[model samples]
Target: MEYKVIAFDVMGSDNGLIPAVDAAIKLLGEQKDLKIIFVGDGAALKKELSSRKHNPDQVEIYNTTEVIEMTDGIMDIRRKKDSSMVRALELVKDEKAHGVTTGGATAPFIAGCHFILKKIDGIERPGFMPVIPTVVKGKITLLLDVGANLECDPEDLVNFAVMATAYSKAVNGVEDPKVALLNIGEEKSKGMELHQKAYKLLEDHEEINFFGNIESRYLASGIVDIVVTDGYTGNIALKAAEGMGKSLLTEIKTALTKNIFRKLAALRLRKAFKEVAAKFDYKNHAGAILLGTKSIAFKSHGSSDKVAFYATLKMTYNAIKNDVVNKLKKALAE
Candidate 1:
C-alpha cells in the first residue's frame, strides 16, 4: 500500500512546533490517507502529541535535534546533514514520504533539496513557484523563480515559463494558461538584455500560450495567468505586492472607522469586506512549491500561523494528487 506521508520539518518556524503540530492534527483529521513524519526534537514532539488526541496510526515522529538557522549558509546543507530540514529532505529522497515541507531557512532548504532529492533531468536549477491572488475574482496567477535563482539567464527564464505553464495547468486548472514575461513595459524593446532575450524566446516558443510582456503594474490585474522572471525581481515583486495588500487593508480599515456615519455604513458592508479579505488572504495560498525537483518539495512562510500551515498542507496534497512532478517532467520533455 502506498502511504501518503509528508515529511514535515517541525522546527525553525516563528513559534516552532506549536502551529506545525496543530496543522498536522487538522490535516490528519481531514486526509485519512495522509500521515506526517514530524521531523524535529523527539521528546518535545512526543509531548505535544501526548497532549493532543491524535491517532497513533496516522502520525509519527522522526527524532532530530539540529535545526538549520536562517543565517546558515547553503554549505550547511552538507555540514548540517542531521538537521531537521535535511532529515525531511532525506525522507522524500528515500521514498519514506511522498512530499516534504519546511518552515526552516530558505537557502538551506533549497540547497538540501538540490543536494538530496536532486533536480529533475534538464533543469539547470530548481525554481520557487507560488500561486498568488489577483484582483480578478476566481482567478489567480503563478509567479515563478520567486526566490531561488536570483541571477538567471535567458535560458533559465525560458525554462521557468515552461515549468510554470505545467504548474498552472496542474494546480490552477487552467488548460491554456497565458504565459508572460514580467517586464518594465509590455513592449519588446523594453527591459534589459535578460528579458529582451527571454521575450524573443517566449514569443517564438509554440508549446505555451505566450502572452507577450506584462508590466509589473498588471501583475494583479489578472491580465496573465503566469508571470515568469528571474528570482531577484520576482522575489522583490512578491514582497512589494504583499506589502501593498497590507497597506490596502490598513487604509480600508482607517476609512471604515473614525465617524458615526461611516461606522454605520461599515456595518452594512461588513460582509462585503469579509468577502474581499478572504479573496486576497495570503494564507489561503500559502507555501511555495520548489519546481524542477525529482520529488515534491515546498517552502512555507517562516512566520506562518496555524491557518497558513494548514493551507500549505492542503496545497501539498493538491500538488501530489495532480502528480505535479511527473507531469512537469513530461511537459519539460516535450
Candidate 2:
C-alpha cells in the first residue's frame, strides 16, 4: 500500500519552507515506492534543495511562474492562473500524483480543489474532514464539513455523516462508528429546522449508528466518533476548541510560574501536565482530508511549522495507502 507520488505546494510558508520541503522529501525517500513532486518556482526550490544537500533527482519540480501570496483572498484562484496551488491540483487531475498536500491559504486550496480535483460521484459539494482528538482511549473523532462547504442542505449533511463515518472506521479503526449531529440540545425539538431535518435523516438511516444528538458541551466527551455539521458551525467550533486549549495552557503556565513555591510544584507535575497538554495539540493532527474529491487532497494549517508539515505529509501517505478516496466513493455510491 505505497503511494506512487505525493505533490506539495511549496510556495506558501512564510518561513521554514525549505526545512518543511526537506523533511517531506527525506521522509518519503525512506519509502521504497514513494516519490515527491513539488509545485512552485523550480529554481528557488532547487537552490534550497542544494543547500540541504538533498538529491534533486529523487524529487521532481513542476515549475510554476506565479506564486499565490498567503494574504490573497480565495478569489485569487481566478487571479493567479499559474499559482502553485493550482498547479499542484492540476497534477492530481492529470493523474500525475496520487495525492496533494499543502500548508497554504485555505480559501485558495478550497477553490483549487473545486476547480481542479473536482467532486466525487454523487457529491455535489466537497467537505473538510478533520480528526478531532478524543478522551476515549486516545482515539480520534472525525468532524466533517469543517469550514469547507459553509452552507449545506439536509442531503449534504447526510452525505457528510456517511463519508465521515466511513473515514473514521477506515483510518481510526473504529467499528460501527457512532454518528451524532451537532445540536443545541439533546431534545428532538432543539436546534434549527435544518438540524431537526438532519436528525431525522440520521435516525431513519440504518447504515450508520446514529447516536441521537450531541450538544457542544459534550464535544470532547468522546461519546461519539463522528460529529456532522455544516462548515460554518463546525469551523467555529473547531477554532473555539483550539483557542480554548491555547488559552488554558497560557493560564497554567502563568499560574505555575508565579512564585518559587509554585515553580517547584510545576516542575514536579510538569511531565504529567505536558502529557495531558500534548493530547490537545492540533499540530499532532495537522491534515484535513478534502472529502468527496476524485483524488486525495489534504489542507494543512497555513502557519504550520516543520513538525506540523511533516505530520500532514504522513497523513497524506496513510490516506493514499489506505485507499481512502475509493473507500469514500464506494460508501457514497451505496
Candidate 3:
C-alpha cells in the first residue's frame, strides 16, 4: 500500500526529540513513496535536518508561529491555534497525510487530535492503546485507555474493548484474541457499578471473545491479549509496572556487586541479563495509538530515544498497510 506521508509534531525540547525525529526520517527513507511532514519552526527543523545530513526534499515543513509549552495545561490547546501540534493534526484532517506521530505533551496531543482529526463514525471518544511487552516470545499485549478519557462510562468501556480487539487482530495478527477487563477482582461482580455494566455489555457481545474480569496480578501473564480499563487506572498501572521494573533491576545490580566472587558470576551471566533487559525495555515498543480516530495518531513518550521513535514510525507504516481503519469500521458496524 502507498502511504502518502506521516506527520510529526517537532516542537518539543525533550533530549530525545531531535534524535528520534532523525532516526524516524532515516528509517522512512528506506521505504518507497513514504514522506514525512515536520510541523514546527521551519528554520529550526531545517537546521536540525541539515546537521544530521538528512535530505530536506523528502520532508515537508508546516511552520507554526506558536509553540505549546510542555507544562501547558490541556485547556491551552484552545488558545494555541497556531501551535505545531495543531497544525500537524490539521494536515491529517485534510488528508494530506495518512497518520501523525508526536512526542509532545499528551494533553495537547489528545486535545488537538480530537479537534482536528475528529472521531470515527459511531465512536463517542478516541481511546489510547499502548502495546506492552508480554512474557510470550515476540508478542505484546494491548492496554487500552492508557492516559486518555479518565472517567469513561460503561458504554465507553465497551467501545474501548471493541476498538482494542480489532486493533489487536489487525496489528498483532491475533485471530479471536482474548479480551479482558481490568478490575479489582476476577469474579463477575467484583468491580464497581461501571465494571458490572461493562461486564454485562461485553458478555452480551457475541462477536468478541470477552473473557471474565482479570485481576492486576495476572496483567503480564501473556494469557490475555487485550486488557480494557479507564485511563486513570490504566495510567497508574503502567507507571507502577515501570517503577517496579526499575526497582528490580536496581536490586539485582546491587546484589551482584556485593563481592568479587558474585561480580565474577554476574559477568558470566551478563549476556543472559541483557536478554532479559531487552524484554522490559520500553524503547523496543512503539508509541501509543489513538484509537477511534478517523486518521492514525501516535503519541510517543517524551523521553523516547531514537529506537523508540523508529519503532513508532515503522508501526505506523504497518498499521496503514494493514488497513486498521477499515477493519475498525467493519467491527464497529457489526
The candidate maximizing lDDT is 1
| TM-score, every prediction | 0.96, 0.93, 0.93
Report how far residue 237 has shifted in candidate 2, in Å: 0.8
lDDT of 1: 0.88
What pairs collide in candidate 3?
Answer: none
Residue range 1-334, candidate 1, lDDT tens digits: 3568899998888877899999989988888888889999999999999999877888889998688887888998899878899999999989898899888889888888898999998999788988778888789888988889899999888888888888888887998999999999989999999999999998998887999888888888898999999999999999898889989999989988989999999999999998888778877767999999999999889887888888888788778878889988999999
- Kindly report the root-mean-square deviation of model 2 from the true structure over all alpha carbons: 2.0
> What 10-residue stretch in candidate 1 is worst by lDDT?
277-286
In terms of lDDT, the poorest run of 10 residues in model 3 is 12-21
Q: How accurate locally, in lDDT, is each candidate?
A: 0.88, 0.83, 0.82
Report the backbone clash tally of model 2. Answer: 0
Sorted by lDDT (best first), the order is 1, 2, 3
Local lDDT at 133 for model 1: 87
Reference-based lDDT, residue 163, model 3: 84
Q: Give the number of the best model, judged by TM-score.
A: 1
Candidate 2: tens digits of C-alpha lDDT, residues 1-334: 4347888887776663675676676666566567778888898877776666444555787889887788888888888889888888888889889999988888888888888888888898788988788777676778888889898988888898888877777777788999999888899888998999999999999778999888876777888898999999889888888889889999989999999999998899988997877788888777798998889999878777776777788888788877788888888878
Q: For candidate 3, lDDT tens digit of each residue in 53-164?
A: 5555567777888877779877778898898888888888888888888878888888887777888888887888888787888777888888788888888888888888
Deviation in Å, model 3, residue 159 alpha carbon: 0.8
